[model samples]
Target: MSNKATLIRIAEAAGVSISTVDRVVNSRGGVSPDTEAKVLEWATRLNLDRRLFRSHLRTLRVAVMMQSPHNPFFEALRDAFSDLNLTMADLRITSFVHYIDVNDFAGTSRKIEQVAAGYDGLIVTCPNDPKISEALRRVSRKIPIVTLVTDLPDSGRIAYVGSNNRQTGRVAGELMGRFLGGEGGDILLVLGLQRMAGHEEREMGFRSVLRERFPSCRIVAALESGENRERAGQVVLDALREYPGIRGIYNVSAGNSAIVQAIGSLGLTHKIVLITHELTEARRQMLLDGALDAVIDQNPRLEAQRALEVLGRNFQRGESGTTGGEYTPFQIFIRENCPTISY
Candidate 1:
């Protein structure tokens, strides 16, 4: 290995062939965008002095569209994304946050299209709809895109900075199983919306783990309520009333407070094992009152920070450096280790 990174070293670091590295570093062509970005990421990390492949860092006009305006967690995420003064690779960043109706696919697509030409980079938490994906694909042709929270992988975004939903789900399963202590019974997965990529992944992971490790635990139903609190509450109440054998619940999406209310109304504060997402104030109090079992939280501030970092790296170094393009580690909070902080 050379003290200064050579083409071979960069190729090895990037897990590509030397010729591919040569093509990317020398702009010789015949390299896919993802491969080029990975090579440049290695070059940047290795300090290889390959300035030819690196762009001159400029003010990045970044537009960030977070979750629905009604979601405080998403609101916090947006606030953090805009307020950060942090930088990576010496690039100056100016972020503009946009709120969109996650369900309004057409309106969201219009918003994306309107901002497409004006922004240098886009960070969005959009629905996994075909039209929205098409719009992102079109925009990504001109500027790099970093998906936040919800991923639009088919959209060809450069990188993602959000929870490893599947792993978080597995974490939930492991914890919930341990809490159940072999008294296996049915559980419910309440989703804020059906088929949201993030929620789907989490459900898959949770179900897979439960099947693999706890065969006796049955997932009776996977319900969706569009994140409507009242509907979520009703679903919970109905599930409780209908299923007498259910001993555990995993809410894979929003409306944690509503679920908690249903649990309280059913007087299941101690009888049922509840695992939900987000560490909002309602959830914090429930955890304190011991009304819930566990809360799976992905910090919006961290997600925002990683999104900005990846966006910077994507445009400047042609790579998204934050944890190999996966970022914002998820946390499992209980009353014992929960931090007492006001969001």
Candidate 2:
């Protein structure tokens, strides 16, 4: 009556060698037809039902809807998520990573709905579009939903695991202001996508802090920097030309290279303060070279790991150790403290 299977018992009952039992159990196919039938007959009667054997050991398939490949920060986050996927073997979880075009909001929504049908759960970097939110609502009725990096407030996701973007924005704004020497000067806010809930929250936080705390610093312009460096650089250059009074830049997205290039072209690298998110090698070098003054990073590795924890708990029907959303703390790095490695 024991549920646990043992090779010795199987071999004795089948009147076969351990090797034959091993072959039979593993489907290695060397026994005669009559012997194979006998082994299978006994195995079934002994409660060696393979499908039922694993009914309690579940496999949870989770689909991860991430961002376009163009954002360097997301690229780093992708790597972290991949590594985390490799470590989930013990939890019986597998990650299916899918990238959505940054410009195609409708396509992203469709993909989410399609992916939901195949996966047991979903983890997405939430988009601001209501279409995507509606898709999530429809799909989450069947499976659990965990919103990563970004969050969909009204979407009834089980939990959110990421840094608070608004706070990240506020920190960036405060740093940019203080680093600008507190003298009244126009500031620029650049983002990769305006419709991203994460970026919008960051912009909101940056604007609110600047308005309330840094009265001297004015946000003269807030513009989009396309995902690519070239497009981002061009947008920044045109913004620079249009707003020559810009004294500081707070990049809420992954266009730091373009913004840095434009600032360098205008010979304002040292004169104007630069604060961006993430700590890529390029950003680290920029920090060392005085091109960028501060960086706000939501440790992607931690975020990825926490995301798995939440999903794993949900799949097991266990407590997630939190009442509501869980946020990975953000880190602020200056030139002196910025680590040389990228995460």
Candidate 3:
């Protein structure tokens, strides 16, 4: 088709003026994301020159927001985003990792609003706070938003890129039950904030599995570590003192190191069956050393890649073609099966 004919078709399909399509096609940068996505979808469908599409595409700045890197899991996620950023230059995609202090809900909400204004898209993993959800809903009106790791289903996000958190919890429960060798014993749950949907789902799943499948196993105590190492250790030590029969421990969020230390200080490392999430270096070492029996893990690198891909698809195909959640696969890591890697 002639250039003029192609322009006409795209303009008609996108319901924009030919001059608007011209600006978008030539990368003059006056179009909104929604309109640009429409034009690009039409251009792709009409088989417009691939070179033109690729060479003239606008640069997309994506902000990846998560908790502070003090937590090993969030630190790994930050690294994943940084590493992936180097390889997505061909797509003209630039990702910036932004840390939010989940401990301060109001501050986190304000930070999200500020970051949203500066980026074309966002990938966030935050607590399900009312203020944060409201901020996300407000910013989503102007730019695409994808929830990562944890999900806020009602927060106006285009998609959630992560594993099935509930299933992860269920798997952890099964492992804990089986590792206890059929003799039911007290189990302790050390979890992150209850406001994080992912953590909540995991706790519920873990509890349900124990109740239905392993009736002999009882959750003697549930502690909120708030992802703090010192706090995790203190709470866990206290719980152990209170519930001496606790034979299994599930670390749902972070602070694996603290949990290990607590168990070791009490000389209960050999007696407790410990399972946690994320196979970070510290956790891997613990697993190998018999401090932890198993880990319910997910790939942060893959999740980061998929989050960016989801944003890219939304930018290219518009809301009609791209708006859904993706469940990244989770793995069970034992000392024998865990891969040896620097990460």
Best by TM-score: 3
Off by over 4 Å in 2: 1-56, 318-323
Lowest summed lDDT window (length 10), candidate 3? 315-324
- Which model is ahead, 1 or 3, in terms of TM-score? 3
Ranked by lDDT from best down, the candidates are 3, 1, 2
Number of colliding residue pairs in each model: 0, 0, 0
Any idea what lDDT model 2 has?
0.78
Off by over 4 Å in 1: 1-58, 85-90, 318-324
Distance from true location, Cα of 81 in model 3, Å: 1.1
lDDT of each: 0.78, 0.78, 0.87
Reference-based lDDT, residue 284, model 1 = 86
Clashing pairs for model 1 are none
Better of 2 and 3 by TM-score: 3
Model 1 C-alpha lDDT per residue in residues 95-158, reported as the tens digit of each score: 8887777778899888998976788888888878999999998988888888888777888788
